[model samples]
Structure formats: C-alpha cells, structure tokens
Target: MTKHEDQRLRIIDRRTLWNGFINLEQITLEQMMSDGSTARLVREVHDHGRAATILLFDPERQMVVLVRQLRLPVFLQGESGYLIEAPAGLLDGEAPEVAICREAMEETGYHIESALHLFDAYMSPGSITERTSFFLGRIDTSKKVAPGGGLAHEGEDIEVLEIPFEEAIAMIRTGEVCDAKTIMLLQWAMLNRAALSG
Candidate 1:
C-alpha cells in the first residue's frame, strides 16, 4: 500500500445494505487507538453519487435565478417539502462544469454563457458519499432557451425565481433560503461583487 494508505483505519469488509436509486453500504472496519489498541466499528454509508450545482448570476440585472421544488424527504419531516436551491443535479459521469450548465438550463431555463468553477464539498460527509461541485455562471435575460421547469419524467415541478442579489442574500438571514450550496455561492458572490460587474 501507499504511505497514505497505511493509516490507523482499516476496512475489513464492506457490503451493500440497500441498493437502488441511492445505495447504502455497510462497512466493517477497525481503527488503531491512540494507545496502540484496535477498535472495530460498523458504519452505514449512503451513496448518492457526485453532483454539481451552479448559481446563475445575471450581473446586468443584478439578479440571481433559483429553483424551488418539493423535496419529499424534507417535507416528510414536518417542514415544508418545497426547497429553494441553486440549480443542481447528479453528474451522471459528466464533467462538473458540463453537468452544472446542463442542470442550469434544465431547471432555470437559462443558458450559461460562461461558468466559473468555485469549489467542491461533501454536503453530508458523515453519511453520504456525495461531493458536489459548485459554480458561478453568467447569464442574461436573452439567454432563455426554453421554458424550463425540469424534466417531466423526473417528477420535477420546479418554480424558477429570479430575485435581486441583495434580496437573495437577505433571504439567507431570514431563513428563507436554507440550502447550503446556495448560501455558499451567494456569500461568495457578495464577497466578489466587484469582479462580477465587468
């Protein structure tokens, strides 16, 4: 094994606990203690694959486009199922930029002119095996290629909202926009305001 692989944690075996649209894998593992002892543990990990999210910014209009859709799991927990988030989707083997652009068009009806890659993050590393690539893409009102509401087959009834950047940021403090990726990109945009305006 490589030097990095010689860690204190070792995987004895791993098996799929549930496999479907999303997969769950249960792992049997052991970790060397601080005092040189070993402890075995079992962990169940949910694999949703990698994803990409893009915040479509219309600098000329000083607005950002976001999507609100029903997220059943979130709804089941007693809160509203509808969530406001940046246009995002699983990579499906595509490059991060390509996937984000495609998702932007599909969910927001806006064709991105240029995309600036921001960063990648694991949204829920404790249980999920999904790392999402974040991006900022420029767009204009004229970039609307279609009346996008997401794919019908995918059961996505998305409501696209184009709100002023300032208001979008304010929504974060009001707890109106709670999606982590959206909050990250919005904060980044606020911090990079000068660059965004030509």
Candidate 2:
C-alpha cells in the first residue's frame, strides 16, 4: 500500500445497507487517536459513483449556456424544483472529458470538440462518494446542431438557456443558480474571464 493508504484508520466491518440506484453502505472503523488510543465509529456512506460537468461559454457574445431541470431533492426542500445548472451528468464508466462532452451535447445541443479541464470536487463529502470533474468549453450559440432537451428516453426534460455571462452571475446572488457544480464553474469563469476570451 502507498504511504497515504497507510493511515491510522482500520475498517472493522463494512456492509451494504441498501443496493438500489444509489448504494448505501454501513462502515465500522477504528481510528488511532492523538494520545495513541483508538476510537471506534460507525457511519453510513452513499455511493453513486463520480460525475462530470461543464460550463459552456461564448466568448464573443459574452454569454453562457445553461440548463434548467426539475430536481426532486430541491422541490422536497420547499424551493422551486427547476434548477439552473451547467451541463453535467454521471461518468458512467466513461472518462471525465468524454462524459462531460456527451452530457453537454445531450443537454445543450452544443457539440464540444474539446473541453478545458478545470478541477474535481466532492459535493458532499460527509456521506456521499461522488467526486465531480469540472470543465470549461467554448461554444458558439449559432453553431448549435441539435434541439437539445436531453434524451427523451432518459426522462430528461431540460430547458436550454443562453444567458449573458454577467446575468448568469447575477442569478447566483438571486438564488436562481443553486447547484454546487454550476456555481463553482461560474465562479471559475468569473475569475478567468480574460483567459476565456482567447
């Protein structure tokens, strides 16, 4: 094992609690404490695998391509279920770049030939094991090839929105853009606007 894997924690037991669309596992582990003592803990983990997301920017028009879709989780929280988000989806065994490009095309109708990888992040580290890869892809709205509303068979009824970059940023403050991956990509765009123009 690598040095990082040689940690003070040892798994005492691990069992699957639920095995549905998303797997839930119950873990029991022991951790060495600061005073050379050990502590036992039990925790549940949700595993849905990794995902990827991309922010499509039109530098010349100073606009961005986003999608709005119903999110049951958000609706359950007493907020609007329709969420504005960057084009994103699960990797599903594909590479991050390949997955994001496919998702972008399916969700935004913009065929992303190449995407600049930004970073990877864990949206909910406490209990979920979903690490999302983020990317930035330049696009031309006029060049859209398909009427992207997502794959009909997948039950995706996404609404494509092409908003000015500035206005999209404003939506963040207005609570219209609440998706974590989307927000991170927008913030990254804000910080790297100059580079994007090229």
Candidate 3:
C-alpha cells in the first residue's frame, strides 16, 4: 500500500465522551507516490463502531417479522413518520447473537432462538461510522404476535408486524421496504426460503 493509504489507516485523533458515543479525529489528506496518477485524496473516517441487527423469520410459516416505529430522520424528511425495520440493537459489549436475541425479546416480546450471522458491513461510508452486523433468526409461528411498544425510556414506540414472505417481497417491490438493512435481510431470506422451509 502507498504512504497515503497507510496514513489514512492510522488514527491521528480520538475523543471519548458521554452519551455512549465517541467522536473520531478527522483524517488529514496526504500526497503519495503511486502508479501513474494525480495526487489522490487519502482520508479516513472515524466510525461509531459495530452494531447488530436481526431479520426474524419463521421458515415453517413463511413469514418474516418487522417493526414499525417513528424515525426522526424520516420525520425530518417529511415522511408519514414511521419506518419499517428489522429487529436490531447495538452490540454494547454483548456478542452479536446475545444482543440480537435480547433485542428480539425486548422489541417483539417473543423468545427468539439464537441468530446466525449473515454478514456485516458499513451502513454509510459518506459520513456515518455505523457498521451493522446482520443476522438471520428462526422463530416459531406460534410466537408471532404484536411486539407491542418499545422501551418508553428510550422514546421507542414500536409495533411489530409479522408479514407473509411473499407479501414482504411485494412490499419491497412497491418501495414500502425502505430500510437498507431490512431490505438486504429480506433479499437474503428470499434466496434461502426454500431450503430454510425444508
């Protein structure tokens, strides 16, 4: 790798603060020699670190569970004020499986089995340091019900909805499934639905 790439990887500054989030230092661009090119902009982002999310699906029932809640960002964007999202939460020192299972129970009121990690990636490279680990979980249909509201302390008022697999896919096509993570998870489920059903 070039010197600029190396510099970008290095953390030049870091500040830890309250409110459970840290602000990372800005990356300084540097000039480096590379194969036949103008000066490259070498800058790195300080991220919010890793998080975990789950797509709770019941293979036997051909249904996937999602939650609806008001998202402030969408609200600011003049939306109708609710977003459909997967069951998710930050790692907060817990393992991804543990975190997702707990989130499923807390957010949906269903005792979910351990989840399988599908993949992990950055949410938005442009500005956010939010890396989310996406998981696939198996839930029983008998447990499917309204998740009720979320923790009032956190200002979360969530409503759980268990939609049929085909209907969920149709929603995605209709642009109703807007959340990136949820979309990705649903696509993954679509690909594996048959095998998962067997």
Candidate 4:
C-alpha cells in the first residue's frame, strides 16, 4: 500500500445538500487515529470547482491593476460589500493560464499575452474544495483595449482601479485591500520587486 493508504481513511457516507451556482454536500468519514483508534466524523463541504487569479503590474509606471465588486458575504458580515481584489474567476474547464487571461481582459481591459505561474493554493482547506492558481503578468496601462466593467448579464458590476505599488501596499495596512488573494499577490510582488522590473 502507498503512504496514504497506510493511514486507513474511509468515507462513511456522502449526500448532496444543494445544487446551484455552487454545490454543497454532507460527508461522514472514518479514520484511524494516532492512538490506533478509529473515529467517525461528519462535515459539510462546499465545491465551486477550481479557479485562477492574476496580478497585473506595470513595471514602468510602478502600478498595479485591480478590481472592486460587491460580495454578499462581506456585506452580510457587517462590512462593505465591495471588495478590492486581483482579477480572478472560475476556470470552468479552461486551463489556468487561459482562464486568468480571460478574466484580466474581461475585468480590467488589460490584454495579457502571457503570465508567470507563481503557485497554486487552497484558500480554505477545511471546508471549501476550491484550489486557485496564482499568476503575475506585466501590463502596459497605456494600451487598454476596451472598457471592461464585467458582464452585465452575469450581474457583475466591477470597478477597475490602478494604484501605485507603494500605495497599494499601504492600503493593505489600512484594510482597504482585504482580499486574501490580492494580499498574497501584493506581498509576493514586494518580495520580488527587483525581478518584476525586468
């Protein structure tokens, strides 16, 4: 058996709880503990499929392109519903590179020929089954090809923002930029600023 098989984990039961734009399911599982005892546990999982996000940077101008949109969850939690985030969207069966590129164009009007694949991460591993691919793409803000505010049919009213790199970092401290993915990419840019100019 493989190393994973040695753990002795089994699924007891699984049932769909909801099916809509996202899928929710209840799952019960059994696993062998470190003390050689078996334990059963039940949990709910949210599956929204895989997704991708990209940070668009203009090295010459030292600015970053971002988007702001309403998020019901944040509003329900008593905070501003609009969130400033890196351009991102569900892959929907497309390749990570292709999905991120399309999202950038549709949300920011920046035509990205290609992007550097930085990493992939599970934003919330405990319950959500979404794994997002992170990328960095250089952009020329002077070459905007379209007026991108997202699709009206999909109810997306996105506001595009261009902030200086230093100011963007300061916004993080002030909580103006609170999206986890955007924060991560901004921190990455800080750590790799030297390479970004090249």
TM-score of every candidate: 0.95, 0.96, 0.81, 0.96
lDDT of 3 by residue, 1-198 (tens): 764466433443444333334555455443444553335353555567678888878887788889898878788998886989897888888887898888888788777656787889889878667888888888896964545567888788889888998898899889788988999988888787664554
At residue 92, candidate 4 shows an lDDT of 86
Using lDDT as the measure, the top candidate is 4
- TM-score, structure 3 vs. true: 0.81
Off by over 4 Å in 3: 1-25, 31-46, 144-148
The local distance difference test score of each candidate is 0.90, 0.93, 0.76, 0.94
lDDT of 4 by residue, 80-139 (tens): 899999999999899999999999999998999998999999999999999999999999
Question: Candidates 1 and 2: which is better by lDDT?
Answer: 2
Instruction: State the lDDT of candidate 2 residue by residue for 52-143, as single tens digits.
Output: 99999999899999999999999999988999999999999999999999999999899999999989999999999999999999999889
Model 4 residue 129 distance off true place after TM-score fit, in angstroms: 0.5
Q: Which lDDT value does model 4 have at 194?
A: 89
lDDT of 1 at 117: 85
lDDT at residue 173 of model 3 (Cα atoms): 88
RMSD of 4: 1.4
Candidate with more favorable, higher TM-score: 1 or 3: 1
Q: Give residue 171's lDDT in candidate 2 (0 to 100).
A: 94
Candidate 2 scores a C-alpha RMSD against the true structure in Å of 1.3
